[model samples]
Target: MPEINSRQKTAIAAGQKVLNSVNGTPKCLVFTSPAAAAWAQNDTLAAGQKIPAGSRILSNCAVSCGALGASVTFDLGLRHFVTGAEVDLDGIASNVASATAGTYAANNGVLVAGGVDSVTTVDTEPVLTLEAANPTDDIQIRVEIWYLPPG
Candidate 1:
């Protein structure tokens, strides 16, 4: 007689197989500017980090102004260090005074390709620009990027 596996065992094996099909894990990259002076300035968050092809990226941003009645704008994106061509990720325009936050993701979680990925050998990083209009006040901006690697 041949031995048979239980129903519970069969289900557990199937679940494991499904999980194994999904490769890589979710990772996060963060960029912050403390005491950013009024006016326009650019900051680097992560630099020269290896990101495999076919990976997806998402970003979130938060800003706080030192004084009221001051408007701030921020642009976040990925920049290729060698080519200097930026892939725009998200933008926060004229945020309210005090504190505000925003979240952004790629179009339907599309994978990174074309020039966004490293053409040579090294990896790329995220860049953020903050622009403030009027008054002399310090602003703080924080950006977070979430990505999933390919299998």
Candidate 2:
């Protein structure tokens, strides 16, 4: 018998199949939220210890007051003995708008936490999809909308 997938599962499967077709082989965007500064940490690392230049990273803060948003700075460090590197940023994503009253776009490529957002005006080489919130500290996210590898 042929297997049947539910609507939601079907949607996800279709999305994954499409992404897998891309030339660069897309990776899922990851998000992290913190209730306090102490909770935020650069614990995750890029797979395979290497990422190309045209790659991108997006980040945002989540808050319940004053349109609070998340921000991050990234940098790369090289281990003396391990021979691996890290990514560093001074101000990767910060002060992104957030919605307070109703359900809002969480991580759509076109929208930020709040209605205010940033788009890839041009085919910039490296882009990082950031996080968006519904105005609560209970959640933190990293959004990966869609990626088309560089030609």
Candidate 3:
């Protein structure tokens, strides 16, 4: 249940509810770290792997690295947060070459010989453009977020 402030209770007793109706308020908040103890999801995801679009990823009250690095290419569609969820693309498309971690990096920072990183200019919504690499390499990616109903 949603918590009602004291003011709301007083208003209710006085017959002066703000919206004149009692319903849960639709709300949103961005999180960079993990959620509280109860915010954990029971599902478990493997590390440095590409999770198919429909698979569910969750945080376990601790900011554990969800997906590793993956290439967000035009052919594969932009990594989506899917309506009704919050996704954190901390190392989206990061390239860890020999470390077994790879991502889409557009020739920036220390990138894997054939890998690149996905870029995003905005939070909540991420738009990634993967760079093409030689025949010898592959891309990797990881995304972190909480699912929520789209507003």
Candidate 4:
């Protein structure tokens, strides 16, 4: 599925526009970051927008921002792109803000890696992180990404 690019691989880079494998359907990751938290710290990995190990994190992605006041702003990033430490701080989304009450879109310039944007090599959980300076109380959001599970 990666025939058009120069850095193509043999494992196949699945996508909606490109060839979609049977297990390469779009997977939605929804997470909510409450107030006073710069990032998403879920009690369990299943609670947030956590991507499974050996998954292909294709391009088609989105994030919905909840009420966080007009002056509120945040950055949507990734955590544990590598195991143990938090990497790719602003890899998922960056320089995004929120409204008092409505849905907003997130900006993801370089997710995982710029070339293909797939989390194929890593075997750790990749969770979406909503970072803010003073994250207004009761802020919420949902991040959606289309990915292919490890085959």
Candidate 5:
């Protein structure tokens, strides 16, 4: 077997940190609807991993308008089931003028504890919420969250 170089060794160490949960990991929540109304929750994280306070949440939203002259406005964020408080990540508004297809995309990030560096006790398994103005319109939303485990 060949010997590993210094740079390769460093890369291996970084990967190990992520595998050990020292570094943050990526989690994805996807919601799709032909016509969606009302607030909906995405699938929760796996049993071992829970979102803690001060964890950074990155959001990306995409919307596809089906009908001409149709529009949809929606907010995507994390909602703490216990407190019933939500943290908004991104809002997407799209309008289709003509019969041609149209799409909207946006990106943003937010810390779980409202910019506070310290962790809060209320932090728990967070569910992604999609609040839509026009839920009857065709749209699909996907939110990705990267977070470090809470100590």
Candidate 6:
């Protein structure tokens, strides 16, 4: 699975810390398809990381991508960070498609201790799966997750 990701910019880090008050930080996963037929490369991004046990999701998960073409949909999920087990297939969102270029998000309010399952017994990693048609232009996808540590 692809573990390469970026941390949210510092501009929001302080605000996020204040909101969670538990050392919450943001995780941004990105995938870029430089040309047609490259989207299939997403298979390599399956089972990416989410969070550690005892962590909490402090904000709604956000996904942004352009409308490469029609019938492009996505599945954002979370799996056990340590065990690499499937946790929530749609932990972020499901059937996310946009007819026009725009952003899509899932209103998954604050996740209790231990992340989405609230078990606090497992870790997590954000997984991104997409269904798309070949587009002549390049495209990129980004996943944003706000979560606190396993305190």
Cα TM-score per model: 0.47, 0.26, 0.18, 0.58, 0.40, 0.59
- Once superposed on the true structure, which residue ranges of model 2 sit more than 4 Å away at CA? 1-22, 38-51, 55-96, 101-139, 145-151
Among these predicted structures, which one has the highest TM-score?
Answer: 6
> Model 6 — which ten-residue stretch has the worst lDDT?
107-116
User: CA shift at 25, candidate 6, in angstroms?
Assistant: 6.8
How accurate locally is residue 97 in candidate 5, as Cα lDDT from 0 to 100?
A: 28
lDDT by residue for model 6 (1-151), tens: 8864333345355454322324445444444333344554234245355466666555466766676467766666677777667777555666666435677774442243225444234767767666564432456655666556653
Candidate 1: regions farther than 4 A off: 1-23, 34-52, 59-69, 89-123, 132-137
Between the candidate structures 1 and 5, which one is better when assessed by lDDT?
1
Question: How accurate locally, in lDDT, is each candidate?
Answer: 0.43, 0.31, 0.28, 0.50, 0.38, 0.55
Q: By summed lDDT, which 10 consecutive residues of candidate 2 come out lowest?
A: 73-82
Residue clash pairs of candidate 1: none
If both were scored by lDDT, which would come out higher, candidate 1 or candidate 2? Answer: 1
- Give lDDT tens digits, candidate 2, residues 38-126: 22233322222322334322323222222233443222211212333213221233323433322222232222323432322222222
Ranking, lDDT, top scorer first: 6, 4, 1, 5, 2, 3
lDDT of 1 by residue, 32-115 (tens): 555555444333334344444445553222333333224544445555555656544332222223324344322221123332
Using lDDT, give the best candidate's number: 6
Cα error, candidate 5, residue 134 (Å): 3.1
Which 10 successive residues of model 1 have the least lDDT summed?
Answer: 106-115
Question: Of the candidates numbered 2 and 6, which has the greater TM-score value?
Answer: 6
4-114 per-residue lDDT for model 3 (tens digits): 677557877899754311223322222331232221122112222233332212211112222322421211112334441334422333232222233322222221113
- TM-score winner between 1 and 5, please give it: 1
What C-alpha root-mean-square deviation, in Å, does candidate 5 show against the real structure? 9.3
* Candidates' RMSD to native: 9.7, 13.0, 15.9, 6.6, 9.3, 11.4
